[model samples]
Target chain A: MPNCRTVVPFSGTPEQEQKLREVIARYKGTQGPLMPILHEAQDIYGYLPEEVQATISEELDIPLAEIYGVSTFYSRFSLNPKGEVKVSVCLGTACYVKGAADVLAEVEAQLGCKAGSVTSDGKFSIDADRCVGACGLAPIMIVNGDVYGHMTVDRVAGILDSYRGEVE
Target chain B: MSENMINLKIDGVSVEVPAGSTVLQAALAAGVRIPTLCYMKDANELGSCRICVVEIKGGRGLAAACVYPAADGMEVFTNTEKVRASRRQTLELILSNHRMECPTCERNGDCELRRLAADMGIDSIRYEVEDLEPQLDESAPHLVRDNSKCILCRRCVAVCRKNQQVGVISAADRGFATHIESAFGRGLGEVSCVYCGQCVAACPTGALTLKRSIDAVRAAIDDPSKHVVVVPAPAVRVGLGDRFGMPVGESVQGKMVAALRRLGFDKVFDVDWAADVTIMEEGTELVGRIKAGEKMPMFTSCCPGWIKYMEHYHADMLDNLSSCRSPQQMMGGLVKTYYAEREGIAPEDIVVVSIMPCTAKKFEVSREEQRLENGCMPVDYSLTTRELSDMIAGAGIMFGLLPDEAFDPVLGDSTGAAVIFGASGGVMEAALRTAAVVLAGDDADVPLVFEDVRGMEGVKEAEYEVGGVKLRTCTVSGLANAEKVIRAMEAGEAAYDFIEVMACPGGCVNGAGQPMHSPFERMMTDVKGERAAGLYALDDSMPRRRSHENPEVKALYAEYLGEPCGHKAHHILHTEYVPRDTYNV
Candidate 1:
């Protein structure tokens, strides 16, 4: 394996640099330590791409398989870069029974993007999860951090329209 | 009393629980039974089942009490009007897509979902029922998958992937159309699933159920011309009582035999009889192979899950597997061949039924190689411990009130060592019992119980000094642990003289044929682990547990088979494996 070093100067504030250093130092000297650091980094930066995975893998001397395994094992970890706004629909049993299927279809139709895929404009990404434990609020959707419960097919376009407007 | 206790208030009740406790645990500690469908303690906590949603003050929405961390000075209301209304609505919605055939469902009485619905007073579902059709995938011999019954709790997925480490099934598709499916929508039998039935045990509802052979067995029993024989597996003795509400680990072997008799079987025999026969054959094979230097570390061939896994992943190591039939198959073969000749009955006239703690044995019984005797499969029907209990109940036989009876002579008697095979590492221990005695040239007075290889631990290893020879042995119960053991062996990190592997955790007591529950309390501290402990206790109490001491086995070798690895034994007992695609592509 060839060792390549590329130094990228940081222009963040001292506090930000200290936080990054603290996160990096937590995974030092452990076997296959890159995943934990990458997870923490993603917690700070939102999503990890190939560049982030490679940087952490190089720093921790862990194999790609080990990092990939950890990343894939956890539901929270995202490999592909996500858009600025995240739209998650709850496909819980309640939501499913309450016609979340049509709601999801409407969201997909309006955004022109499948769940777990980013929109063409890169403004939003849609992801479907098992449950957020809010089954009482059936057919629920979360945009950015605000949850929209009791969602309908007509409501989906309006929900995404608000995000598009905010981004603009 | 000062061991880092955390005080939390649940529904106005101030409860003190140990720190690091989840809000669910605290509520449970305070005698609040928060209804949940997908929160089996330790086994699964994926929060896929939203039935246990509770109102946490200032917390984000309703939280799944099973996984959410309970903080100090937290106000948690488990059963407020808001919580009850929400839970009722959630239950109603879940029922909208679910098949409400509880009257005819196998898990009707014991189902967690049914119990929860009744407890929550959900008399009817107000939502419009969807046109969701139940997919009854019955291609596998051991189990059936009904997608309509599934709540998508991911309990089955978690147990399959994390516990068993066999990723044959997972949540496929997305949104409301999402369903748990085998890879590429292939049948489970087509996938590299070992048929251990751990997924069945983990499922909260009627989504996964054992493929029952009770009807077949009943038909055979009713056949006037056929002599129906029952072979109870090693672990069945310990768990047969759980179906009757008997305390876990209580030996219901006698009652099991009685039940079989009541169910109109001609003979009720012990599978342990053949387990002893297996030890004799496998133990002797190991010795001969070791002496000839043909193959070292001969694997036990009893667990069908381990056998199937080896057939799929380690085909090259097939030579290392002992060519000995499992006790179930051995007994089946013996009943059809040796016993048939003695009774002056045709082999076709004998209906061999095996009652086992494993669902994998259902697949094992149906295997083509198992038909070595008279061109017929040795075991005609393989029923699970739960199935046997149901049959007993169906017959209206008073299990507890019935007198304790003995197994019929010739095949009913089994040694104490054979009983342990019901748990993980039991096969290795049973083999060691015979192997060590044979290696010592005579049955020595040394303790036969290999304590190191016993327990609920995922993996156990022990090195024994037997008559100047150091024999390294290892036992792994769960599939994930089995994967770890195989990886270790491949990496040369661990070397063993023998290895025993079972596909389910805590062995056959937790097999797919066992009870299914979600939001299952901690097995160790709850009812499930108690049943497992019951199995271990039965093994400890049995007298003459060693396989060599079974008179039936001794007589079979003396009258029919010359020795353990004789030509007659080899022709009838041993089997081979076939390779499978791991990726299911």
Candidate 2:
């Protein structure tokens, strides 16, 4: 499966709302459409807010609880808005064995944010991953899709500084 | 042997089963026990657990007996070494991820997983257990969810989605991270949960249990200045003996009363008496609606689960719901006001505790609309039959040995119609007994039993004659069925003067807070049917079969209140509804 771009929150503009409506219109009647609709919805809106899910639920006639269930069940979906610089520390089995927990702690301390949460300014967000499939490069971390292999706890500070003005 | 009957052999024992029957069904019929975790017989047969796996001759791998069909001359080995090994591995995998908090768990002795583990003689886990971050959800009033105790059987999810049509919970995440939760990973109390606790009843482990009110009752009971009056629902008696070693459908109302008396309740009353009063107010409301031609189909407002479902999904039909409080709430209101005033005790001094066949009652009493002006809760603490049974045993009372005793006189008298409120179509039947008489007036001889509405069909519609007017009624139990009836009503395909809806299938007899059916009990007996029949038997044995004929209700109205649905009854027994968004978070 190709990587789906899951960043870029909705500006709450009319165009984004229309795009969301079109996504719901395209997938409403398909068999088991909630997951797909949610996937597309997350793409259209960056993350599923209560309002986005409510729109899909209204269009598809699916219960909101069910849509929420499908949305939460898949780790790929995010309920909160993503920060400009999305930092993910791979806690996959290989990474954990190679001191990924220390790397995660370093990332959180430097970015001042925990997994699944955005920083106060919303410029930096952090999360953990299962595997980036780069197990050979154990203890790998990603900042805005830029992979840093063999990451040490000490090297985390340098990585954040590298991405510091790259937000624009 | 019929032509459709297929012959099968299980461990060299020959058995004949219907052609379409599953191997599990045939084995069960042959008195063979195969353990199951995810399988809930007909309700949920997902076959995900793999605990009920059996070796099929000439098959490549082990077959899940729950879903595998039995073939003619099929040889199945259930207790073989390979089958046992596979079952053990499956259980071990489940156990590895499970929290293993059996000692302090809520469902310690009553859990299916704990029983299976003990039966298999699992001394120690062979696999590495997952170190999980414990999550506690007390969002809803009646239920608590512990993801650590969950085995991902999906039983609760299936029951919630398929049976109730209120899928407030679903299988979230995947693999080791998989656990059941509400949409968007929000707390259940934050969502549109109906607080039905069907998931709690369907759970095989302590993953789900009630938000208990035992401690509050104990505190009230220990307070010398306070008078805690207890009222048990009609269905409580039929299923109370289930947790004890007694047979299913055992009549333990008398012993239940005796047990409550010994538990230090100042007054042990019957909620059925309030059920009779419900019939008076609700029946009067039906008569008024029929006569006024307002709100074409007046729905019964008895089931809190159904009411919450309406607030979320069918808020437009709020006008159709009868404005009367449920029997539990009605009894609560009366106990704090009428009963307290009669006994010369201050309403504040009276702590009303209700023992019910529903977990939703706990949520119901706490509802803002059900509280009085001075902030005194009508029913202070609501306990399920299961909770009450546990309390009785905890107090060292020998339930079976206790002699039969009657309830205290003030609020104890109940007729047959009141008692049948525990079963599906019962409220309709009970309401009909009084409504017809009120509507018929001179020609008020209605039949004691309305057989058309008295069965286990998902939705039953019946019409009866009252004087020259015809009264159409629809009775439904499960919320799924309730949806169908509402849809039909919307489409103008059916119309009714009155409609009764019970959130649990088979009504309170199969309530979520009632004694649950273990997988063994599910196989052994028709738990709902047996309990419903016991209620009907009690209904038959009573001399007065009509709610209006209850002498106590008659005297209460004659003495305290002027008439049913009068100014005083409206203030004490009526309620309002508000529309809410399905997803709050």
- Candidate maximizing TM-score: 2
Question: DockQ for each candidate?
Answer: 0.03, 0.44
Clashing pairs in 1: B39-B519, B40-B519, B248-B534, B249-B534, B249-B535, B415-B545, B416-B545, B417-B545
Docking class of 1: incorrect
The C-alpha stretches of model 2 lying farther than 4 A from their native spots are A1-10, A72-76, A80-82, A88-97, A112-117, A127-138, A144-147, A166-168, B1-3, B131-133, B373-375, B442-445
In candidate 2, residue B314 scores what lDDT? 97
Interface RMSD of each: 13.7, 6.0
Q: Chain B TM-score of all predictions, in order?
A: 0.95, 0.98
* DockQ of prediction 2: 0.44
lDDT tens per residue, model 2, A23-92: 8788777788787778887788777876787788778877666776667657788766778888888999
The residue ranges of model 1 lying beyond 4 angstroms of the native Cα positions read A1-168, B1-3, B517-536
lDDT for residue B179 in candidate 1, whole number 0-100: 72
The window of 10 residues in a row where model 2 chain B has the poorest summed lDDT is B439-448
lDDT of 2 by residue, B16-127 (tens): 9899999999998788988888998767998888999999999989999999999999999999999988988888888998888788888997899989988887888889
What TM-score does candidate 2 get on C-alpha atoms?
Answer: 0.94
